[model samples]
Target: MEQHTVVLYGKPGCGPCVAVKAALERAGIEYVYVDVTTSPEGLEHVRELGYQHTPVIETSDDHWTDFRPDKLAALAKGLGS
Candidate 1:
């Protein structure tokens, strides 16, 4: 995979957020974890993206909310190119 950035916005005690983090780690995908509850910028970013949920994954080409294994799989596949 070429150079890329993936940001995961989440808060503590969020189940889906934990799942998303695990999935990404298992896929060997590097990501930045931003605690929305602690970071004002992270909170604003998610709000700007129109998401009212945790585990909001943001990449250069795409962004989505919740623990989407399908989307995560797609992202892993795309990284091969």
Candidate 2:
């Protein structure tokens, strides 16, 4: 199966971001990390998503903010096959 493209929007030292990244890595899910702290476009994207926090996870069909273990697991499992 084709690998899912996961985009993780976060900052450099966000704990939830770290946790999310770690979870994705553990699940063997490849992802693109977007550091909103470093790029103006990244920040703009987050704002467009109507979020004011870091650690936003977005796939081609879905997006969310904060840490959600169940959602993360589902994304990993869905794409891992």
- Give the candidate number with the greatest TM-score: 1
Score each candidate by Cα lDDT.
Answer: 0.91, 0.89
Cα TM-score of candidate 2: 0.92
Model 2 weakest lDDT span, ten residues long: 1-10
Instruction: Supply candidate 2's per-residue lDDT for 15.
Output: 99
Candidate 1: which stretches are off by over 4 Å? 1-3
lDDT of 1 at 1: 15
Question: Tens digit of lDDT per residue, candidate 1, span 18-78?
Answer: 9999999999888999999999999999999999989899988889998898999998888
Q: Which parts of model 2 are misplaced by more than 4 Å?
A: 1-3
| Model 1, residue 1: C-alpha shift (Å) | 16
